[model samples]
Target: MSVLVEVCIDSIESLPIAEKAGAGRIELCSSLATGGLTASAGYMKQAARISGIPVYGIIRPREGDFLYNSDDVEIMLADIHTAKQAGLNGVVIGALKADGRIDETVVADMVKAASGMGMTFHRAIDHCSAPFDALEFLMSHGVERVLTSGLAKRADEGIGTLKEMVAFTQGRLSIMPGAGVSPDNAKRIIEQTGVTEIHLSGKTVRNSLMSYRNEKATMGSGDSDFAITVTNPETIAQTIAAIRA
Candidate 1:
């Protein structure tokens, strides 16, 4: 069996680059610096129009915890509808309750809203209190795949739990290991966890092309405003090669 590589890209420019690099799927989003928020409608449409591979738009509305209110559910549902209309192949979504359990109601609504499209429960599963139980819930709700780090900070460090998840699923759905995955560790993660699918963002910094700079004013927090985070096709290619090798 072949391993599936899903590259998480924050911009449309990276879509073709990842596809050309042999990524099996694309998880499109914005503000990946802050763990990825929802992509703009225009960005989603542009990505869907040009990408050759499957594109799954992130449906998150904000950067904080996965626990959401009613308004957040409405926003996520609207985003799911937007993704479906934008020609995206699927949506990446997850929501939890205040006590760290899967929010059944909100997730059900999201699954229903994304009726015809593929659905992937994002890394939010790492935050769940009962991961195995949560996996059962997601599987029962018709979630086609799950992007998790085995309830740890990084996939490599969570190999034991990841192994258990793959075994528990029994091939019912995809158990993809994501978070802190790199070319150096990609092959090891697959070999140890028995997960056929993996997720990564081979991200690198790109300097902006502006001759003039207004250092006195800043648009957002963090380093120079001239730097932008973009996907590195070479890194993606290298990671794919490592897994296949």
Candidate 2:
């Protein structure tokens, strides 16, 4: 089967580049430089309007930890509701217990709440106390897929575990690898893991030259120059080609 390239995008402005490059789908989020956060409804709608490919909204409220409070969970639920109403194809989300166990109750609720919408258990699966158990739990909960890095720092480092997880999943669930997954490494990972779906942010970050007239600038670690953009056609094409190769 051909590789499923899901480009992680921050805004609608990045659409043309992704589409022109032949992407099959998109993972919508903002501030990817900080892991990822939920994008605004207006942004989601605009993206859905322009991107012909299936767009999946990410449900992360913030970066840092996976354990979310009740309010955070409520916020995620509302975002999911809004995302579905916006005609988006699906959502990527994950929640974990303080002890690193799968929050079955929350996960089940989320699965039920997203009954009609496609739901993917996000990278939190990688943080589970038990990967195999979490996989079984996710399958039983009606999750469409689980994005993971085999509980390793990077996909390359976790390739073996990913392959094992794929075998454990059989045909029941989609075990997708993300984080440091590249054209140079995708083929080997896929070949070993036998996973059909792949996710990536096939773009590079360059400092925006446009100076901000509205906001004041401060000297800190966070700045546009320090920021990175995602729209590297060459890298994306190379990665896609490598996967196809």
Candidate 3:
């Protein structure tokens, strides 16, 4: 079977790029620099309208730890509703307790909210204390897939654990290795881990169009670097080809 490639994109512009590059699906989000918070309703709706491939809306309410409070849970539930209404194909969600385990109750609620859409447990699984146990929990709860980097900072570094996770699951659930996935290593990671799906940002820096430079002010933290990172179609195509080969 051909490996599935899912590109993580933060804007509507990248949607068509990913689709054209042969990505089987997209994990739509905002602020990918901060590990991808939830995308706005407007952005989600636009992506749904234009994307040729399936778009799974990321349900993260904010950046930082996956451990969330009641308010955050409520916000995530609302986001799932918005995604469904916007005609998205699915939703990616993650939540954990203070003790480093799956927050079953909250996850159940999120799953229920996504009744008619595909449900993915996001990479927050990397933050859990027991990944194998968590995999069983998610599978039992009816989650369709889990995006994980094998509890390591980068997927290449975590190939050992990823292989183990894939073996343990045995096709009960889909295990997608993500984080730092590049064209050079995409094939190796898949060959070694036995995962049929991979996730990547496929991003490159593009300089701003403004001729007049403003060095004094900045929209985000640090200096006003006129260049912004956006998904590169060539990179996505290369990664997909690597996996296909």
lDDT of each: 0.92, 0.82, 0.91
lDDT over C-alpha atoms for residue 192 of model 3: 93
Model 3 is weakest, by summed lDDT over 10 consecutive residues, at 221-230
Candidate 3 off by > 4 Å: none
Q: Which candidate number would show the highest TM-score if scored against the true structure?
A: 1
How far in Å is the alpha carbon of 46 misplaced in model 1?
0.4
TM-score winner between 2 and 3, please give it.
3
Q: What are the per-residue Cα lDDT tens digits for candidate 3 across 1-245?
A: 68999999997888888898889999999999999989999999999999888999999998899999999999999999999999999999988999889888999899899998999999889999877878898898788899989899999999999999999889989999999999999999999999999999989778788899978888898466797778999999998877777
Candidate 2 lDDT, tens digit per residue, 1-245? 77787778885767768777877788899987787789999998988888888888999898887898999899988999889988898999888899998888777877777778888888888888877888899888778788888889888889889988888888788888888888889898888888888777876777656676433564445653545577676766787888887
RMSD of 3: 1.1
Query: What TM-score, to 2 decimals, does candidate 1 have?
Result: 0.98
Q: For residues 158-223, could you state the per-residue lDDT of candidate 1 as single tens digits?
A: 999999999998888789999999999999999998899999999988888898998777788976
Question: How many Å off is the CA of 178 in candidate 1?
Answer: 0.7
Q: Any runs in candidate 2 off by more than 4 Å, and if so which?
A: 207-216, 225-228
Full ranking by lDDT: 1, 3, 2
